[model samples]
Target: MAKAFRTVLGERLRRLGKSIWWRHCTAAAFLVASLFVLPARALDNMSFVVRGGEDELTESFRAASLLVQSWNDGLTDPQTLFAAARADYGRLVGAAYAEGFYSVVVRIEIDGREAATIEPLDAPAAMREIRVTIEPGPRFTFATARMRPYAPGTQLPPAYGDTKPAFSTAIVDAAEAGVDGWRNVGHAKARVADQSITADHSADTIDSLILLEPGPRVRFGQMTISGAERMRPERIARIAGFPTGETFDPEELDTVANRLRRTGAFRSVALQEAETLGFGDTLDVDLVVAEEALRRFGVGAELSSTEGLNLSGYWLHRNLFGGAERLRVDGAIDRIGGQGDTLGYELGARIERPATPVTDASAFVEARVGREELADITLDKIELSFGLTRVLSDTLSAEAGISYIHTRAEDVTGSFEFDMVALPVSLTWERRDNPIDARKGFYLQADVTPFYGFNMTDSGAQFKADARAYRSFGAEDRLTLAGRVQLGTVVGTSLAATSPDFLFFSGGGGTVRGQPYQSLTVPLVRPSGVTVQTGGLSFAGMSGELRAGITEKIGAVAFYDAGFVSDDAIFGGNSDWHAGAGLGLRYDTGFGPIRLDVGLPVSGTTDDGVQIYVGIGQAF
Candidate 1:
């Protein structure tokens, strides 16, 4: 069987360089002459010369030579200097070839003697002077570019021939593209069988030919699992979904790794093919997994001027019942000192089993009890939910759940109790470069919960969507512009009948930081014909930030946020809007960023004082 295609992508970047090693002849000679006077321990200078080729090519030639770069930290030992000189001979040749120079001459000398002629084991007692010269004879243009037995529709780089500058990287790229095209079509064992690359110094031209060998189309055989502790092998295989008897695809391997890693049960997953093929010409594969610790715990805290302090923690079991099942319990307490009159607390527990009912989905069950008090409303609720989450793709996922809640509310308008049964469906798509602190890419989340109310409560559906985008510009991506838009609306339910959790509020760190928490509520008439402030039926929010990097780990940002809330479910009548603007600082902690933002209301009737928010991770 032909071997699989394998090449290091970094090999292309290893060939880097710009223009000129010496300005004038006198400077070069003077430096060489003065090197003898410098103390042996104080080796100072070297004469690096590019005798021919463009300034860019010449500069690159020297930059790619180890002997030239060693001038900065002069070699104290003779053996190291001899080794570097010998290595430079081959390194400079490859560097020249990268720039299309096929016939290049590189010479390295120590004390006027050819270092390549000296044995690497021999060391000079003391070194002061060294000389490097690279003569890139001529840049070569491609004469004939050809490849045999390539997959149909595989296109080689257009610049591979005389039409444009010939880069040696183009050859490697062509081979890779050819094999990839074959692999994409189920030829998993496709490979570069043979290659003929020749150069003509007389004409300064290159004639290239590549031959690919596509082995028999193969299917995936059974996968053998190893390195698993506490996790059941059968469950590991089920979670991997290893596609036995199906045509082999490299993407399937990646999907298996992603599935195992997503469960958080494994610290690492590695895949490899068997030494011999299985029955029916199938490729047998092996999965090696390193399971994570059995138990883990973490805690976090956040502070806000209006919302007060929030402390939260969670305990998790990665493997439960010998399967890749996850069990987590979380608790939180808030409102220690803030606008609210009393504190609120919540405790929840969830259990998730991977590869349940579907290969790409997980089954989860959750139960929770909580109390929340904000503005003129207080609610105590008990809830339960059962759901299935599916990983649709690398950057997309979806969830559908049946949720039930029993709510008791006390509002300024009146007291209400509601029992609701809802079906919530949500989809999330994200492609951020970094989730903790994104520099580019976009994120989108949209969900709808349709509910049936019992016990005299009104039935309704709630719709919400959040969209965020980030763009980076300037040198080294020093600046990033981020923006977010959020919208939510409740339909089929009146403001007085909807649960407070389903309603929208337009204040606090999460909405408008400068405004008081839940301060921008809508007024609704009660049965007594008296109007009172309450959560809105419709809401819209927008946030924009300009972030600049001041240092590797420190950053600064300026931002603006605006929110709108309305009593009408359709978002038209009796609306209130508020805006806040602020400045913030970020300290990167490797995993995420620590955030500190100070904000104040800029528009609308809201709180007048500045609000300070301290938390972990980006505000968005």
Candidate 2:
């Protein structure tokens, strides 16, 4: 029995060995076939040589840098760098170098390191310099731009198409215009893809093509709002951007939704779009909300030049009485050097109702007392004020209020005490260009304020206008220019001996990047060893920026800023002015441009100051 079993096992082992050998042989044959059948492509090449003068080297280096910036990878290898120069040189050949000059033989030296050389070979004395002439291509007229439905809907129709023109030489322009039209129709996520532009030089004709994809059209379906149990559903819905009969826009929806969430109304607001709708053109919406704790506490600190050695503490009630009302108490102490010292405390509250749409309003009241000692005078005052503000439109608003004040003025010689009342009215209008993705747009603003003082105090009228324009040179570069002018005049028979110390002033933080606040002010009298305060004139702040993106991430900028406070009496009328110019580096953050600008005074102050600002969104 043992012998028979051994014989069977031996036979099986021999069979297994034969099977393994066959498999190995087959794998070897497959490898050989692959090697013989595949094609061979070269990934490396020989280096080239270039040599020229310092001037030529400088120009050549600039050209090389531009080429490298445009390239996907900034090639540093000697051989690869040589190849790049050779390719660039081919484009320069026969091209006009100057009025009577042209490129001859451009070369690169790559023995140890990469260096480009340019040669401006002179023609024979008998041959006049050849000035190459350039001819403009055929002019293609712009055509009509229209938007068609991406999906069926009963909402508003798109409103941005150009009805008159007939041809568009640039497809990007047409496609962007089409998208703008969709935005007007309340479609915020609208986009154009597969863009193509065709222009026939012989026919002098053009064709613009694009595919429009309007993402989704949503509406206010249902909601479960709880944190504000004291509030009504209809009220919150209207203020939340999903008004009844209102066409859905992704941007508006996103903005208002986030605002509501930030209000600490609910622990969480879960929003989703339904899969189907009763109306073929409508989108069903659903909202699930959870309530958060009604009250909370927090504290924060920041550094600033204007406040000077300041510290603040505060406590907050997120949802006061479960009614979406916000209450906060804060205290602060400030010690300023050379200027003076101030110590004050304030209590403020914000109350709101979720149900009101256009009428929904928030009222705030604050009371404070402070003592300030300046070089010429000491001001100690107690003030109380309240205001009611409303958001009339998405970007427009108005506020009105009244205040009561008691003040005592004193100097090294004497002191006096007085009480007064103030009634103020203010109106504002703002239009944000591209609130969602602001690549190109313009913002316009106008603000007017009128105030009245009781018992021969002080009263005046103030008007301010600000306008900003933004333009993209192409996909990556942008040009932005902004100007703001503020003017105010005191006009009351009961006005006190002088204008209020809190009147509008320029030169610091927001007005000019580097100058100290109100440094532009000029005086008619030399008080406190500084300048005297002459009558005020028109205040002008103008800034211009040119930003070009070499790639999607890196960019460079050149900018100029000029500002002036033209006192009606100083320098015979419009003389006090300051101007600065400089360069900047920018990193494109998806939200907007993250900028760091290095500026130097050009004409006014002797200080070579630098300004750095970091925030979310555009500078304007």
The count of residue-pair clashes in candidate 1 stands at 1
Per-residue error for 181 in candidate 1, Å, reads: 2.0
Q: Model 1 over residues 398-424: C-alpha lDDT tens digits?
A: 999999999988876668898999999
Model 1 weakest 10-residue run by lDDT? 16-25
TM-score of each: 0.91, 0.50
305 Cα displacement, candidate 2 (Å): 7.7
Candidate 2 per-residue lDDT over residues 1-620, each given as its tens digit: 12332233233222311111111123233334433332232223332223333455335434543234333353333323333443443333212121111223333332322223211121011211111112212223324333344444323223213332222212334455556566556654566544433433344433434567765553444444444455456545654655444676556556567656746667777666555543534555665566667666654332224334445567677666445666766665543331244443334344444323343455666676766533234567777777777766666667766777777766544554555566555666655466532446566655554555444445554456677666675443444333334344333322123333433345533556555434565443333454433324346677776766667776676777777665442223545677766776677777565655556667676243654433233345
Q: Assess the local accuracy of residue 432 in candidate 1 as a C-alpha lDDT between 0 and 100.
A: 93
Evaluated at residue 477, the lDDT of candidate 2 is: 40
